[model samples]
Target: MNHFKIFSTAAATTLLAPAAMAQGIDAKVNEAFATVTGPFVNFIFAPIPGTSFPWIVLWLVAAATIFSIYFGFVQFRFFGHAIRLVKGDYSDPNDAGEVSHFQALATALSGTVGLGNIAGVAVAVGIGGPGATFWMILAGLLGMASKFTECTLGVKFRNEYADGSVSGGPMYYISKGFTQLGLPGGKILAVLFAIFCILGSLGGGNMFQSNQAHAQIANIVGDYPGWITGIVFAAIVYAVIVGGIKSIANVTEKIVPFMGILYVGSALVILIVNYHLIGWAIGQVFAGAFTGLGVAGGMVGALIQGFRRAAFSNEAGVGSAAIAHSAVKTKEPITEGFVSLLEPLIDTVVICTMTALVIIISQQLIMEETSGHYLMNEAGTGIATVGGNTGVALTSAAFGSSISWFPYLLAVAVILFAFSTMISWSYYGLKAWTYLFGEGKTTELLFKIIFCVFVVIGAAASLGPVIDFSDAAIFAMAVVNIAALYPLMKLVKAELDSYSARLKSGEIRAFKH
Candidate 1:
């Protein structure tokens, strides 16, 4: 208790000192981050004249689509097999890894399944209209292929530590895959991947989770100091993560299922109450998906919105999920790979779709103006500045229209989502950090302490530009990961063939250690 108080006080001081130092601290932080992330975002969002989507996003989508087709739409063909694998029907308790398949999926899902479903979907509908949801679902479906490819490679190339620990992700794949190919510059690419993974872990995984979680907490509990929330959150996270993958997996398996069911159940109720508008909402989704608002220059705008939200939500190609999936206890990497495909499907297709439905159905009844600009009213409840007109609060308003308790429920859900996300991300960042720096108890402790400290900073400070950069970092990792996978496609196909042959021959009736 004394240590907790001391840590809390230090966190408070650290978070508050920046604001106290200079009147222009906010501006300085924003400017500094903008300087770094600005060009990156621009590059990613560069328009493609022939298509409505940004060139980078389009390229990613096209890559995922072709891979899915090339692999015979493995996501669709083996959906049942994946389900069976996750059910532990093929699980061997003595498998040479740390966690079960279900637990691994939970940990991975915890990272991707949070605010991206609730707040992100809300933002998508607000900006892209109902049409964006359609594209988001489409991208998520294709992303399954991306998830399978990266995670399979993750397991294939993973390293088992001397202490019986494991480390794997894009860094391992980039280096190992290239080395196997006898390619030069593999080390450079591996280092690049490590750097980006660190950035991504800090920004998207850690800071972003802390920021959103703090927002929801503040919304519910009133103006409790940001540092207080940050400190408490960090402490909880530190405790769980210090114990490693087994501990993280245990907590996530419990939290992810409970939170997911709660949020989805609430959305289901709203949809059921507004059942009459279901058809209209579906029509609008398809219409907007194709025609857009006619403002984004037709199909191009629609495609862009869809792809952006999907990539952001599912994070299929980003290589982050591979970190979690790598911990699964299995000899057949393909088993875990098949299970990983379900990440995008559940995160984007199901959860995101639910959030979109609630917003679209509510919007139709309110007849509110659909513009991407924030509107503040005297009631102290309005659209957020960052999201323009289509933000989380707007979706909250829509939910509030049908369910009086929805705002509070959404707030709670957001907090849980954010909290779960932060804990999972700590593992990802720690893995990356260990890869760069030597892995020792002292090094591990230092990273944990820094990670916890940043949680407070992310909560108290405005992280608009910082998160943007982090998002870019994630996409950049995807660029490297997918590039590696392209050359290693034959290896994945070979594994798939061998696994399938075993199953067909009934030689693999069950999992063996």
Candidate 2:
């Protein structure tokens, strides 16, 4: 308790020091981060020449497409099997790993199913119009293939430590799988992946989450220094993550289900209440998908935004989920891959789509009948926002427009989603940390401490460049990871074939539950 007070006091001094000083420091921090990371961020998210489309998004989509074809659309063909695997029907208690298959899926889901679902969907619908939801679902469907391939490799190449804990992810797979293929630059790629993963874990997974979580809280409780929320959040996160993967899995397994049901349930209630508009909304989604419904860039704009937000929300090809899935206790690496297919489906196809439908059904996008275009802001580049609100605020207004108290409930869900995401990513960053610095108690603890500290900083400061760069860092991971996946995919396919043959022949049978 004494240590807690001391730490809180020191953190407050550093984060809250008079408003004027804090503002200056925040500006300097953002500027410094922008100066250092701006070029890299631009390069990572750079648009294709003469086109608005981000090549990175294309890179991920292309990979998802290739894997879907190469694996014969495994995400769709074996999705039922994936559910059974998650249910422990094929899981052996004697398998070598840390967490159960369900726990692994929960952990991975926790990472992907956060702010991107609530705020991100609103952003996609806001700019891309209702049509974006159509493409978003398609991208997510294709993205399941990406998740399946990477997670299979994640489990295949993971390092099992003497103490029974395991470490794996794109870093391990890139290094080991590349060397196995007798490729050069395996070590270099591995190091680069670890570096980016750490940065992504800190910036996107830790800071961005805490920042939004604090914003939601401040929205509810009048106003206070963001550091206060940060400090409290960090303490709770530290308590869970310090216990390692098992603890994280335990928390996420509970939180993910509850928060998912709560958020999804709320969206369902609103949709039912507005049942009369359901057909019109569905028509809008289909029509807008093709016509762009007067949205800028028309169909193409919707396509880009939908694909972009789905990729961001589900993180299918990002390789972050691979880290969480790698800890599953399964001898057949393909089983985890099968289980992972459900992630993008739940995060994107179900939850993200639900959010999009609610917003669309709520008639949040105002259209001018004479012009047949959305009521745009002064610039007229995109759909106009309500009272200048965007992201979560916009989503909240849409919900509040129906059920008056839903916004408050949504706030609680946001915090829970944020908290769950932070813990899952903590494990992800730790795995990368140990891979780079060597695994040990002190080594792991150090990363955890650093992660917790960043939570405070993230909540307190508005480091836009830092968050942007962190997001780029995540895509940078996809660049390296998907690049490696192409070469290693044949190996994953072989595993899939063998697993399928055995299951078909009754050699691999589900346990009697």
Candidate 3:
């Protein structure tokens, strides 16, 4: 243990050495990255003509809504069965796939259950008021159908190799499902999706995670260069992801549960401690949803902010989870679909809602008497911060108010959340890379190396334009993925029907029994 500690300390020192030398480099890098990515970010996030709504968010919301209606609200109907499947009640060990149902869920959950659930939810509630929570929950419920559709297709169309490895996700499903439907340009659509997935993996999944994790650490420990934190995180992430999906799944299965318990348990403690305010906080959420609590644009502002943040937070319609879910050990592709729907529930409904409740109950936000608008901060600037704190720091303040030592715990949770997200996204990005290039160890290793390098960049620099562009790239994936889903959703429905019938007839019996 002593030897291990010494080596670890030495490694950390080596990593920090560059931070001291690279004092002025962050500004230069951020400026250059912003200049290069500004146009693409603007184009991707551009509002619909004559409207403030970003077309990408509209695209995701529309897909989720349509899928919910078309699937007959399958997310709700099969919600119980999803839980059973996750528990391995219907799993067959003989199934041809890389990981178990639970591990697959954990992996996908790791990707979406990151800074977004913490900081993003806080941001939504801050600007949109507590009422945003209602719309966010509503959107998350709708998104369940989108996840159900895409993941079923992911499993159905995946390619199993001779070495027992698999390659799947939007790229496989789009190309194969479209061809089966006699559609042209299937490969083109698949290619575009792959490119976007890779970019999203780098920016939102990798950089944003590392950036926030470093910020949280800095909040607790005095200021230091972000590159040091980035390098250490990159090294740790590469160790897990280098082993491929099965390895990533193994680590995530353990980390995700512990991370969830720690964060949620803390939230639960705060909620329980402030039990008296629970009803009042909930009332605020409902009132804010419709009245907007005097926020700008009233209910419309709350609606937009809630929907926008929920779409970003749960990532159900984004189709990234489909990539992770595709690796599940289930012959019945629809079983994974059932399992996938729970992602939005766990991510948005449970976790994001918890954060929102804590903020509301903590009285981090206040209503102005005359204007009736929610005061963003103590100074009443409408900036949606507490004492000039924003994002995770704002959330820290909320939690710290309830539990004095919670900020330290939150920093640890942030690091774990960020690390899990990076490893999972590394897999997502790798699959996309291998899809575009051929599958080979050498090619895969190159992509992994590049991914690790970006972890450092993300931590070290504040590339707002680059991060924005990456976010656009992530949503752009939904554009191609959901478009593909629309044409091929009937196939998923057919699979679901068959699976449900087989289970009813005892053809798909519970192996555990």
Evaluated with TM-score, which candidate comes out highest?
2
Give candidate 1's error at residue 20 in angstroms.
12
Writing each residue's lDDT as its tens digit, candidate 1 over 1-513 gives 000000111222232223432236755877786786678766755567865455667667877897898899999999999999999989988677788899999999988887667656766666566678888899999999989988998888888766667888878877888888887777787778778877777777777677666767776777666677788888898889889889999999999999988888988988998898888788878877787644334555556667777877777877888998998888898998999999989988998898888887776666544543222223323222323334566667878878988888887877778778877888888888888997888988888888888888877676566666776677787787777778877778888999999999998776454
Candidate 3: stretches off by over 4 Å: 1-25, 364-385
Model 2 per-residue lDDT tens digits across residues 224-243: 88889899999999999999
- Candidate 1 Cα RMSD (Å): 6.5
* lDDT value, candidate 2, whole model: 0.84
The candidate maximizing lDDT is 2
Report how far residue 120 has shifted in candidate 2, in Å. Answer: 1.3
Ranking by lDDT: 2, 3, 1
